[model samples]
Target: MESIYWVLTWACHRRCRHCYEDRFRPYLRADLEAVVAEAERNAPLVLGNLPKRMTYRDPGGPDLPEKMGRVIISGGEALLEAVRERVTYPVIEGLVARYRDTGGVKVVLQTTGDLLTPAIVREVAQRGVWMISVAGIDDFHVGMEGEAKRPPSRRRSRQ
Candidate 1:
């Protein structure tokens, strides 16, 4: 159950008022090889308690040993338009493919519900990733220090 989280990029579409207004930049390129190497070194240590002969599926539909570890790909809104336009989607997909090919780790994705399109969900399913959507209600002011911010319409459920 060891997990590695990689922040592949820094670009986001929606700006949270709390985010630093002056510090916004996208990751031009991610060092995939470095990230993989780090995962390879740390995954086994994290999964020390897991069974020794575990098996898992790779992105290419092959089953491989789960001796290495689990990995998670995340970013500043992984599904944000800026990230998608930059390197978020490709890096995540490539990581999943490599993890599956190696057959030694699990892959998960963290995202905002705003970008969970049907096609994206299908692709995630095919890659055997566990998608976690983070959302919550807060009474704190969005822009002002104490003023409450109104919830966005996109968060409303259609039931």
Candidate 2:
């Protein structure tokens, strides 16, 4: 496989007309923590076994094989304030640290710009996110108001 398209959560801050996902869930902190732990344990092995095609060359150095390829993280909005700093950030950091030596894992974050702030952008960039794909800006996904579509408070216990 070329890259892992990881959906961190189905919860979103928008109810876009064009969205493919019809149902959303309010993912709790523990749920996210558990996911992070699981990913941390298994992701490297899965990625390592994938076909390595990317090659990295350094000045006055030999070409090195890229062990892991890329990790594309997406969600209703991965940058949503509810889970950004706690869950999402840790995943990005962990991936970067794990594959920093072997040509580095290209971490791509996908989101809608509704919840992104300058500080958050800066932090993710620093944490080795190679790209941020902003989506849902067209007429189908207009009306950025999030209250109507917002899932129940993520802090609430799952019923």
Candidate 3:
């Protein structure tokens, strides 16, 4: 079973000083059909893509394998409040359901864990998603975003 990490968007609510350039942008909706098509064709262990906000390119051009090993969903902050307010959760849920139906791919949710709440976690778990929190230790602020603006404590957690 191979794995592929997909970057869904760059838009986020919190303005972390250490945030990456890609984080400050609008969300771009990829062509899910194309992405799935490609995945079915390529049994990649690890796959990642830029967020919808980062590019206008159509991702609905390839055919993916039906039995992918794993699928990772990521974004500027996978659990960003704004994203959740918008449509991140629904999209994630839909994808998870589709993948699970195949009984071949395991969905992994990559998040910062900042905006994530107990309810959200429970919902994700119910959908059979494996949550993976990404965070940085020591100078976490510096690593998150290059520019140092506010106090380290005020800055968003690296995760």
Return the TM-score for each candidate structure: 0.49, 0.63, 0.51
Clashes of each: 3, 0, 25
- Kindly provide the TM-score of model 2 when superposed on the true structure, using C-alpha atoms: 0.63
Question: What TM-score would you give candidate 1 relative to the actual structure?
Answer: 0.49
Error (Å) of candidate 2 at residue 28 is 10
For candidate 2, the lDDT comes to 0.66
lDDT (Cα, tens digit) per residue for candidate 1, span 1-159? 355666544544445565544222333335433433444454334445333422444556445533456666665556654445335445545555555544555666766455678887776667566555453124331232222233454344546
lDDT tens string, model 2, 51-150? Answer: 3443344345455433446778887567766667656887788777666655667889998777777988899999889999877554566574344234
How does residue 56 of candidate 2 score in lDDT? 41
lDDT for each of the candidates?
A: 0.50, 0.66, 0.52
The C-alpha stretches of model 3 lying farther than 4 A from their native spots are: 13-20, 23-68, 136-138, 142-159
Q: List the residue pairs that clash in candidate 2.
A: none
Q: List the lowest-lDDT window of 10 residues for candidate 3.
A: 48-57
Task: Specify the highest-TM-score model's number.
Answer: 2
Rank by lDDT (best first)? 2, 3, 1
lDDT of 1: 0.50
Ordering by TM-score: 2, 3, 1
Better of 1 and 3 by lDDT: 3
Which RMSD does model 1 reach against the true structure? Answer: 10.2
lDDT of 3: 0.52
